[model samples]
Target: MKKYLDIISDLGEGFGSYSIADDSSLLALVSSANIACGFHAGDPRTMASAVEKSIENNVGVGAHPGFPDLVGFGRRAMDLSSWEVTTDILYQIGALHAFVKAYGGELQHVTPHGKLGNFSVVDQRYAKAIAEGIAMFDPSLIVVTMPGELAEAAKKKGLRVAYTIFADRTYNDDGTLVARSNPHAVIRDPDTVVERVIRMVNEGKVTSITGKEIEVNGHSLLLHGDTPGSLQLAKQIKNALMSAEIEIRRLGDWIN
Candidate 1:
């Protein structure tokens, strides 16, 4: 545990450039940043600014691609063909990579956001499509995915996989996240979030909403920057992990 913790911050719609939470404190606490790529939120300017800030803070930058549903904020599921999903991913990654290159930085990873990520996990064909898209873009780029299903698919496709877990979210008995629509899904309490993360890192387990302890292989921990009290929770999570002898680092440093 002391050598393998990567803290990530999700920069979504509610916490874009126009929001109060998009600032240095959040950037400082996180080692990897998932920046929205215009589908769910963020424009060209916001993406460029976020990329610049991430580089300035020496944090790893990744593209946060989502469904093309601005009205739904990419949270609502949509029926998309595998090819369509693959093309969407390529467009989003290309958009962010251009900004990163302009700033003399590299796009380190790709994390599908919202409904796309949820659907990809349960649908192996969708997962493979996403993996192929990432592999096509650059074989060296890592794919940050939900720890179990999508990560396995990406690995099978020979893409470097970053198995990600969420610090501010609840898990199901099978290690999938409790649906966001559920009342217990989002862990709003900072102390609880810290404790859950520590247990996941040290014991390789997460207590699900049903009180079942499920095994989890978390290569990285995600903190949703748009969630209420997210920055405070991130600080507490990092401190607790460090106290427990877990060393937090960027995902790029761990990927082969």
Candidate 2:
């Protein structure tokens, strides 16, 4: 396999068989998939099918756990306690794991989805609880987290952390992701996203929304399948990374 970063594709809420767009794009570019685990988007059938497809394409499978908020699409922040967050996360991961196991494939990692992910980065206690829950369930499973804060918290909790960057999102000067509510937060331009990622991987720097240089590290890159033109973006990103001779790997491979 060609050694620089891992790429994961996110399959978002209630995406059933009709998620052909997501399925096709995920199979084509990503080495790993962060599949929605019921709470936010997928049903049992959808989870099973996604796991089967991942196996068929030799892609790594990961549980994408989110708050139980299908109505909000798990985007709205909830006032869940750390215990509640842990339980919600475990429930989602366990359900997805059962499906993957029944299909005779292993779940390689856990990535908190949507609002839960954002909260985990800023709330050390919440991040610790999530990491602890994952470690309790399967110590071998890698925890895919935003680079810096969340990763640091997971590491402290004895969970293997896969520091991730977003291929289609903007960053702030503080190295945190720009809030999604902001107009410039999502990188909609395919060429611009590709250019930014290239600089991040090759130069270890990203130009934040404020036009300030910020240092960042990425073990994996994510493409949100829900975004407009997500499929095209994934294809372009894969091609650009290959042209730059950066190897793409699954989070599992790195953790193992």
Assess every candidate by TM-score. 0.95, 0.94
What's the C-alpha lDDT at position 205 in model 1? 87
- Check candidate 1 and list the clashing pairs: none
Q: Ten-residue segment with the worst summed lDDT in candidate 1?
A: 12-21
Give the number of the best model, judged by lDDT: 1
For every model shown, the clashing-pair count is 0, 4
| Candidate 1 lDDT, 1-256, residue by residue in tens | 1468788887634434365355578888989989889998888878888899999999999999999998888899888898998999899999989999999998899989988999888888778878878888988888988865677778887888888888888888877888978989998877778888888887788888999878888788988777777777778888888888788789898778
Residue runs of model 2 more than 4 Å from their true location after superposition: 15-21
Error of 1 at 247 (Å): 1.3
Q: What is the Cα-based lDDT of residue 27 in candidate 2?
A: 78
